[model samples]
Target chain A: MLPRRIYQFFLIYLLGILVLLSLKYGLQLSDYVIPGPKTLWQTALEVFPRYALDVWNTLQVALIGQVMSIVLALAIGIPGRSTTWFGNFIKAAAYNVQAYPIVAIAPIIFILLGDGFLSRLLIAAMICYFPILLTVLGVMSEPVADVEHFYRCTGRMRWQLEVKIRAFENLHKLTTVIAGSATLAMAGTIVAEFIAANAGIGYSIRIALYQSDLARILVALLLIGICLSVYQGLLEHTGSLVKKAWTGSA
Target chain B: MNGKTGKRNSLLAAAWILIVLTLAVAGAPEGRAWAGTLNYRLKWIYNASVIGDLYASGKGYFRAAGLEVKVRPGGPERDALRELELGYADFGVASADQVIRAVAKGAPLVVVAQLFQVNPLQWLYRTGKGMIRKLDDLKGRTIGITYGKNDEIIMRTLLAKAGIGRGQVEFYSVRLDYTPFLRGKVDLWPVYANTQAVFLRDKLSRAGEETALFVPGDFGVRFVANSVVTSEKLFKRNPELVKRFVGALLAGWKAALDVKHQKEALAILRQVDRDTPLRILKTQLEITRRLVMPRSGPPLGTIDFEGWRQTERIMLEQGQIKAPVKILSCLKPML
Candidate 1:
């Protein structure tokens, strides 16, 4: 799965590059508008190491952000799974927070938090937790009738047991959603850096953008793609392991 | 027919090709006019800084010149140079650094007219914290600069000229919010002298604070600002069209800057910039006039060749561009 993900990303990146190249040559565009192969290669050589480090920094934030989002989502989701007023209130509040555009709120965050790592982490979690929370809420709310019925009839259906049964039954769905959200986490972190943060691949890309250096941006995108693919692949692999262990198949 | 007849026909064909090539090189006739809706993209949104451009469009100067120009606004994401290459815009406003960098990378753009004779970019600081009487005053100050922006290049140039090392002063990364500057967290925040300077000074004034501007030009750092631009191909192919457009634009500027037409210009600005009060817009326009057309300065839209060269040299010294782009060659001033 990891190898497949890497190759698939490679193919997509290659296709995107080819399309840019075709446009460049087709329209007789200069390197400023669209970087030629030589310029792109030279830019890669120049900025690769710096951008790699930056991407690693971004990924670290993203990984922590993903974990935080998962925790926050599960915490809210598990408690809000009930049909009580507290659950409904929590759902409405989370939805309201999501409605406010992050771009609008990012300035306040930066002003309060000073555009540091903490701000990036919070923005990333804010962006990534919503979809995960929705899925968690759906999965937690829907009763697993057959398995949950066994626990309920014998009066063994405590809230913990109820949650365990539901989570166990929907383990595959939960794993898929969590793995899928890695992209969101990375995207969120990037958006944070692009808006205000000073130390990440997104910030570097912002600098390149200001300079109108398409070659540098292309190089940054390549590194970001590779790093994201590898991280996501590892996440899926870990999720599979967790599933196996949970089912006693490990 | 005789062989002489065939020789005469071949000579005629060659003469026709030579004539056509010569005409193409000399450019189309001065009398010739192009009739089409052309796109003129500004570097910023519709604000007092773009009064002349808006005046031109709103007052039908484009139509008077026998052209239909769609004056489009630019923002952070809108790149006029790229748009020119992609054939989306016929003309644009770009800063000297942008033009030089684009040219360094082989983007075939030509500057036709300079808008701001005195660049509007300056650092605004509160008056209480001792004036920047000399370059030495800049040391030990926490300055706000957008890391990958023109202000950074200008500030670095200023610091280097003052013989200040990187460790000598503090640099705060700036963003859209001015909370840091407002709360007195940073000194020497960059702002456009004509627009943001006016706004910020007024805001600080209400808070019982006095402010001053640090003009880079005053310190002999004359970085060129917004200027009219177009593709080199368009400039070469239709010199008459370029001439007419620039002529109309400068006329619009001259008229807009005229005190008699202040009401008209303000009305046009009010249409788009509804957020700013009329009083502030008036002040911005007055400040803009000084930058766009300084006293004893050249006529409106006059290309500042020396200023552009100095700007290019600064960029080169600062490693913003890998090498000189021969920026003067790209200054195909219509007037």
Candidate 2:
């Protein structure tokens, strides 16, 4: 084994090297956003207040997008297993949407829908719809022949049976699909925001690039990271609540 | 199995609701016939003097043309040529080097109108640091060159003119943010004649610090700085549209050039450069106008072959460009 003192020194040296490198190239991302260092701190501080509302707008869009994607997945998935047509159509739509890049479609959406919450919402929905739909379809269509036979023998009403019993059975799969949709939806909103927004994190980044303020760019990235973390935390919290509710009902 | 399908139907309804919610947010666009149509990419950002000119052109004259020019202010990602290539923009405000490089790379971009008659490439240093009085002293000095193809090309040429060889001078790619010149960071940096230098002076004036500016034009490297460029396809397809567009722009330039229009142009630029003081902008515009305003021999919008050749030779020597580009093909006459 290496000596303890030597290991400590090596670790410190590596950390020091990493710190130096981050400082050196850290400005690269910022240079893409803001151009020069002139009055950078002041400019960033001033702009931060304006972005509060923009961030709120982004969050709202992402939340709606996640919900929509989850819903789409279930709708397509449920009927898909019954008939190949339903399954193929849903799968094809998802794949086709994914095939075209978001950047290409965003401007057109802005043109058609006009620049506002609606255009961004549609862009986000388009993004979230495919993945969730596919997931839900797969989960909902999973082997349930035994459950169906039991209900049939009992002559239970299909509506009461589906609502009261069958829906609760696939809780784990539903939770997983929803989690994935949330992540995908966030990505969609940000990418869509890049094209037409006069405000939001995307607009801020775009302006930061033009001005050449690297610090502001990094700040925006940091803000996105925070937003993602909070979103994930919320997703997990909601998942637990869902699990608890399902357990209590059962 | 049928029960799962029932639940799925309800989820689909939720998705539709989301789409409707988004529709609710997209209200009618505010004001004007030309709104949301035009997109413009600037060569740089709000701090540059050209922004005022662009703003004046867009809001004042170009609006009359029914063109709502969205000035996409530039930074590192503001590759004017790339914007055209990606179809993100209709037109771009770029430098000659950008146009030349794009053309070299098989991009069919043409310079529509010349904005700056003289380029603003200069070395800014402390009043007395090393033997930097003449170009030759630039040898072995560490120079800070931020970004821009022209900055890199011109600095190389200025060094060559001073008899400095490759490896004679160390280069720091970091921009001079008026930070204290650390020995390891850089020795000198290329500064714009009006903006960066003036910005530094104002900082000094406000905080009671001392600094001096050295203009590159004084040392004999004068090339046109900002030029209006569009795709060759656009030019060919709508020659009259291009002419009409340029005609309106020239009027904006003429207005901006006048002493009276300085206040209006500065106000427009301030929308972008909230950090840039008006007094400093006026000083920069005055100095830059003097340096870049057209001379008697060459008419406005004229590209000097000799000037182009000098830049071409320097770029070739420095390995900035592999092959020399003929400058005449790049020019689009306004008349």
Candidate 3:
């Protein structure tokens, strides 16, 4: 029997061919000329190098956004969870903000913060922040009566206790939050770049669409997929390292 | 902890503190001094109409009227009236026929002004492709048209004129793929004569591709395709703004026609149109100039009332519109 990976690849390839066939013959469709077979080949050759660069840009934005989100989420979650007075209000506000559509928010962000790396970063951070915040808040809120009692008996200062016990103890939760936020941040960056952009994958997609060239559009999408896969791999590697360190130390 | 660890921790803590401080300081809403910004959702991509917006901006006509037009280049996914209805755009340019559809559907949009006096819809093919001189020649031949109600109505009318029934001709959705006809995949394709045809012939001359164009006007089908428009409610509220905008845009259109400025305008068009060729661009410019400056009374940039009536008659006959539209009511007289 063929290897499972090869089998799956074959299946996917067959399905793609079927789709192309349907678009061509099944619907009795008239194939468009501009981005037809010849144009597709031309674009495929021209776009490969540029596509690699765009993917790099996308990855860089996503990374910065993910890191910012994790930091902001931790800062918000820790104090908001520990404090009683504004805890519910802060959590509700965060949730409400998370509910706003990325597409609707992108234009406002673009206007308020001009098209810079910082603006796109902020959009990515905003989109990714909620998942990390919620996850960190949930993890921190988990009952740790024994640890609280130990800290109380030791008469440790709040800052010292938080650093040694709370922060160090929740490494897994933080890593998971970072991983999830990184994925969301990538999505947000794409949305932000789609509006008021001069470069990046989203801008390329927009240009392709205006010219009504489907090949470049598909190529852009393919490049994005590759970029996301690489990012996910990095996230998983970092996550596993963190997990290993935490486990080994214990 | 080591001295290095202490320094790194202090830097991180300071950064966090700085972020919080910045957030607090930036939370206050700034006063709206830039309130005169007019968001315009264009009907299509960076084409002639989009260049018109650029020209209008460059000439400071919009600023002279105390407005800053933000021209948002639109696509197939965008709904211009929907953008206007949602207050995303102050006004937009779209088909006069769309105005009838919008009004019938209870959409609060009205025609504020007209742009093109004649629609540029045409059936283009490579010459000597199986006797395609008349409409009946389209019978049993593969025809390329967009899969829209309006396109269908236009094709059906043209087919009927050629003494061909619906079943005789095969309707294939072109989806703006201009090359399929050149590749011999289909016999005929509908195109915007000013835009697509120019791109095909002029832009790709070096590529050695050839095309022959047949227009709907030549076939006794005449309609105005694009018009400057605003919401009915917005029109009632800010009639002066609409008037100023129309005047400014007319000025922009006039500037586009100037022989001296045509090169500058073409340069801007070329910058935006990476795919279109120089031949196509010049062809579009000439064709558009002819249509806009038809050899008749009221030199150029004038909407024909009879043209609107003819469009409505065709649309109504084809069941594209429910009720008859009054052409005079649709016209916003140039002040």
Please give each candidate's TM-score: 0.93, 0.50, 0.51
* Tens-digit lDDT string for candidate 3 (B98-182): 6665554445666766667667777777655564667777777888865433555677788777778768978765532344565
Residues A118-177 of candidate 1: C-alpha lDDT, one tens digit per residue: 999999999999999999999999998988888878887899988888899989999999
Who wins the DockQ comparison?
Answer: 1
TM-score of chain A of each: 0.97, 0.75, 0.81
Q: By the DockQ metric, which is better: model 2 or model 3?
A: 2
State the fnat of model 1.
0.71
Total backbone collisions, model 3: 7
- Judge candidate 2 at residue A54 and give its lDDT: 63
Better of 1 and 3 by lDDT: 1
Docking quality tier of model 2: incorrect
TM-score-based ranking: 1, 3, 2
Docking class of 1: acceptable
CA RMSD, predictions in order: 10.6, 19.8, 20.0
**In model 2, how large is the Cα lDDT of residue B99?**
61
Model 2 segments more than 4 A misplaced: A1-250, B1-36, B66-68, B130-133, B147-149, B166-168, B180-185, B205-210, B294-300
lDDT tens string, model 1, B82-127? 8887777899999999999999999999999999999999999997
Residue B147 displacement in candidate 3 (angstroms): 1.7
